[model samples]
Target: MSARQPHELLLAARPVEILGVALSPVEYSGVRVMTLTMIDQVHKRPDGTARRNFNEHRARLVMGEDFFELNQPNEIRALGFSRPQGGTPAAVLLLTEAGYSMLVKSFTDDLAWDVQRLLVKSYFAKPAPATDPLASLPPEQRALIALMVDNASIKAEQAAQSQALAAQAEVQAEQGAAITAVGQRVGDLADTMLMLARPAGAESIVHIRERINKLHGLPSRIIDEVLRQSPIAPKPAGMVKHSREEARGGSYAVYWIKDVSAVFARFSGECTRITATQVTHPYIDGRFKLLPARDRP
Candidate 1:
């Protein structure tokens, strides 16, 4: 397939397993700088465009020096896995056993939120009505995921309530405007994509339903299509959505995500838990001040 524009590229991201992945430190010019400012921009423009520069930094990153490591485990977590045999199926909300196994290894507070969002969307597949879906997590990590999910659920429910209040207010205000209420209609997924044939702004998977909720004339999907293709559509950072398909023993499920790193980094600033400093050494006596000093008083 041709390279997708960045906004649309999220659509192509699919859930795949991480194999042979390990986290190690970097050697910035023989200096070990341990701290990682996860969301630092290398070549991002003023308008948020990450310029496609294929030079030293981009080239090295593309070559995969350090993939996002969820939490700390020190020189472990095999990230250097062989290329997956088949094309990585678009990362779905539900990952394959191997993929999820690798994923949980790197789970962090950020990841727990992501899992909750997916589970909410797949409300039908929630493990239990009031129970936490992350129950399967290890005892050490379970509390963390559980706490994160509880907070997220509360927030999401609150947001939904706020949206409802806003809508009610809008309806009341528009009552005198005689805005005719529109009823439901139906269309398949492709028709929905056609609406975004010319996307206005970036749209992430999470806001689709909410966007669709505001329209009052035609079908919700139509409203979604229009908003998604409108100039104000959001450019979501992390998750992707694909055509509906059977996933996790359920149908009509099609959300996928690839860059948990971007998700966590964007929301919480600095997403990774494992990053070592590039060795920072002053002098080798024989070659005093080998590297130029970054600061001179």
Candidate 2:
């Protein structure tokens, strides 16, 4: 190798600044600025106005990589009007992350409470779906309080709907029971009319229906429903025949009554076995095959 040149070692050292400007009495946000060095230069305009310039005043009104936190006086002062070191920048006023949060984020009344809750929490956070796992993991700074609030609101709505449905079901069950009871009362009225009154003694069907409703203390709704829907409700016209008597003068739309004895006697031409439970039934077993005098032979 050739011998090293006399200036070979100088190439490795940082270059020294031999040039700069100077100015003073400078103020920033009410604070007096002091520079490391100041030099004076004067220029006389053609109009005879002299403008003196500072070689480095505007070059670095403010500069540094370190952020000047506006909220904290100490951090702001920490910037200290010094030149940048290493790769750090110069002449910049830093806007802190917290500063942007207060300035940019806004909430209306509906979401205000959720934001309040979120502010109190120190360390729970979720990330955006599109964010990378590497960026999200070990989260030193992030939160998903808004999403949680949305979920809680949805659950509250669902619970309210479920309660409403349950109440509707209860009302429907009560209505069904009332209809069944009204039907039973109307059935009893039919059997009584069948056994005790012949056409000559019977009243008008409409009149009899009102009497039965009043006698049973049935509500108007129940009364109307019974007349409309009950199988045993006396119709506006007709008659039902029975053993030994063909009664007329009321709708025969009466519900079935099990009086095997009555039914047997009517069909068989006999007046025996009148003690059978009065319900609607063809027969319990083939024993009913013995019914009717003519069929037996």
The sequence of per-residue lDDT tens digits that candidate 2 reaches over residues 16-118 is 2212222223223322222222111211112211111222222422232111213333433454433345432234333122321232233234444343244
Task: Tell me how far the alpha carbon of residue 97 in candidate 2 is from the true structure, in angstroms, after superposition.
Answer: 34
lDDT of residue 211 for candidate 1 = 36
For residues 192-241, write the lDDT of model 1, one tens digit per residue: 43331223344444344443232211234433443345333334332233
What C-alpha lDDT values do all the predictions have?
Answer: 0.32, 0.36
Error of 2 at 287 (Å): 54
Per-model TM-score, in order, reads: 0.15, 0.23
Poorly placed runs, candidate 1 (over 4 Å): 1-140, 178-297
